[model samples]
Target: MTARALATTCAATACAATALSLLLTSCGIIPGLGGGDAPAEDPAPSAAPDAAAAHRELPLTRQGRMFIDGGGDVLLEITFRKLQHNGEYLMIEVDHDLLEPLRASGTSTDRTAPIRLLDPVTGEVLRAIKDPGTGLSLGTYFTEGSDVTPVHQGIPTTFRRYFPAPSHDAGHLTFTGSGLGHVPGLPVEYVDEFTPSPEPNIHDYFNEYAEKTADELPGELFYPEEVPEPGLDASAFRQGIESFVDTAESSTTRSGDRETISLHADRMFDVNADEPTAEAAETIRRTALTLRENPGPGEITVVGHTDGSGSDAHNRELSLRRAEAVRDLLAEELGEDFTLTAEGRGSEEPVAEEGGEDDEQARARNRRVEFVFTVPDTAAGAGGEGLDSAARHVAAPAVFFEDLEPVATAEHGDVELNVYPLVRDGAYLFQMVGFGNSTLSDLEADLGAGEEVAGGPDRVTEGTLGGFRLLEPDGPTRYVVRLVTEDGYEDFADEVLTLSPGDEYLALAVFPAPGPDVASMTLHAGAFGEIPDVPIR
Candidate 1:
């Protein structure tokens, strides 16, 4: 995968002494005992008690409460107060209530910005818009001069942010950020026009600062009359996808309109030789079946790569020969209807770094063959019956393993991992993992250091479960954790939690949903080994 840094142009400032303390209403906070101009009068009762109750009952779709610190201290409660549809943009409102006191020194310039909305089924990630002139993300920073006001203990602060309105028809989208984890199934409320709240907003504060320091900052402060509204650029937007592993020998990845299947070259050929092994044909045949099941348009490009062990010239020549050999066999398996091409790029692209303590394992990952092509629109989440043999390559889901569970639990040292049943949310699957620290002192666990199953790849990140995967109980296909990426930012579906002694941290992982017909999966939890019979809801 190509890496791009997500550039952020906003920062937090020092905490201001003044903030509002408002009462809770159905859709928003009632403006009450805060410092502002005259508070707007509360709306009158409409004489419909049931309707008001229903409105108040609207739920915020999120997992367990998120904490500022992973040690279960410093609880930070978040609420999706509103999602109003404005012209060309969606106005998002969120409330942050920090239960514990945060010191003024604790305020970080890098902490306050950017929220994303992900439409799982459509694979669209929506980011907050930046003003073309200033490149500032269009959101509230609660700034006082140059620093942002920290959330004082027991006071709730509401933030208003804006993103380009989704072009799709999804009624709900997943809300995610560094503070709030993956919050799925949030309903969007539509409005015909945008109205500024009576709250003391960031613009008013920033505008005052701009005037006081006119020598340093010179520009039009706030433009309420001419709000920037950029048109939707659908053609330029890139779609993200989940990676699936059927076995140690191969893995499948879908991105936007294309799909790429990677096969382990070491398993297909002998050392320093381009000839296919006796067992290579079966793997190729299974791959052919997968292609036919999820048929697509355009020429399938077969690319070969080798490890950085041999001479560059020799390795390139050998990789080319291997690519040609695989292309010839694929042509025989797939009839004359499909066009195929071959190329070799020996050691040019390496997914894992080489000169490390686990150099050999990284080298093993570098040697592979890839088949790239465009997948048809109907192919995603399309179910298929894979071969019953151990080398199954199909994308079918597992429907068994629900009744046989007390769930599964495992331990590595003082840290214990308890993986709960899976929950399916549209195009994604959510897995909640309960972590417990049994010792008297805090324990540090390195998830990336877990031993691989049968020489498979290691975990990608250390504290989080980024390298872990979910496998089909009846087949070899492994559904990896969905990676949410933007510009230069990337994170797995899990969090980096600190395990305090006798305390528990319930984390989350979002994976690509298999077919709806599937019911059970096996989690390859790093350090904890294989946990089977994990039922999906």
Candidate 2:
């Protein structure tokens, strides 16, 4: 067709499809748009066979976004709403709440226009058509009379929305008339993603949400059957395990050369869907930054989990979906330095007890996404794995002068200083410098970059990089010595220490030592300049 002819036909098609699309826009059974087959679930309340019990079950993607009318009165709300797409079209399921005055009052509301799908990025208004005789819809206490007439409280108003499916690269969009709030960059799953829930379980599944029995509740209680172990025991150590940090929402534990960080699934996901909420994505992004700062040579494993809810198949699918979602986000942030694997453990091996129906809160704890980091065999195994590791950060420790030995001494005016190497093992090395004031006057070493080093004896600066150059090693390096305290580590340059008459002061320095061969290093003393080759022993 010529450009003009195609344009005319396209406009006509959109216009022709609008009316039917409005009827199918409410949700479920999009007529011709549903990839062809109509789902088993009932259609709109008017099109379905039942009116005595028009139940609109809540969907898996509800986000509880309020859609208020011109007044501040919330006319509609979306909870657990999610968006999906086939290669050809977009499928959106919204669990909604239509809070009308009362259906018995015969009150009605107005739907300003058929739902509008606006590509938030390009401002393009995509057209949609009625997918007749296709899709699934069910309702209870829901009357699909007009676009507005919501049933009273306790009855859910849910539906499936279909658009011409945006470009594959399209991310978020805003809805004006029917649905509201922004849509996420929903990754598409094939139209026949998986066979919908088995036939018999259909009603049982949708109806299940109406009655709160699923252990998949988040922030809700599902007490565990097995008592949580009071604390990790020594036996845990023999299993090649090291130390661990844990909290209600997340936990980081260590093994030989591996560290595993687990973030509760509820913290990262909602209901049975896989797309992460913005809050969850932010949390993941933070973790990625930490890893960048503390780069580790290890394999990454992302584990997705669900609580004891739904069938084995359903839980497995949901868990896998969530894990894959997290993996994608992590991959984007972490880059190619890390090899990541995404897997799912459907409620199989829960950290909680073999909880039954009563374990609602306990089950909440079970839903989580875990990241397992496995480092190079020997390097990671030498220590208690990540015992000393941060998300990728390190802080200095407190230094005490009492236990240190003077490896070198220098006197600057009224102050005498001595250096001591306290610990030198593995990647970390520490030293303590003690200061004593022998004169009546208080002493403040104007070390200021320790310029006195160049002025000190050649014997003092020979073979060394000069001053505290030893403090800053060259080439492939490890941790370096810096002033450290119980409060946290800081640069020696940042310290403002004073020594009074007859007073003794101890200052600590930390370093990322490269090897175990270092027997001595030059200690740059304030004003005193470089103390020649201070012995490590």
Local error of candidate 2 at residue 201 (angstroms): 84
Candidate 1 wrong stretches, greater than 4 Å: 1-72, 84-88, 98-115, 130-136, 144-147, 150-156, 178-180, 189-228, 231-246, 266-282, 351-367, 376-416, 436-459, 477-489, 497-503, 515-518
Instruction: Give the local distance difference test score of model 2.
Output: 0.40
Runs of candidate 2 exceeding 4 Å displacement = 1-241, 354-358, 376-537
Question: Per-residue CA lDDT of candidate 2, range 220-246, in tens?
Answer: 111101111223121211112132334
What TM-score would every model get versus the actual structure? 0.69, 0.29
- Candidates' RMSD to native: 10.5, 32.0
lDDT of 1 by residue, 1-537 (tens): 000012221212233321211101001100011221222232222111121211121234221222222233334455566777664677766555644454322212221223457666566667665445444444554432222232334545555556677666556666655333345556677777766754443345554552342234332222121233557442223335544455566766665557777888889999878899977888788777777766564579999988888888987888888999999998899889789999989888776678778788778877888888887432443235332221212222221111111267889877787776675555566566667778877666656533444323343444455567788765555544444355432334444445556545555566666665567888878777888868765
Best by lDDT: 1
Model 1 lDDT-worst window of ten = 23-32
What overall lDDT goes with each candidate model? 0.53, 0.40
Error of 1 at 4 (Å): 20
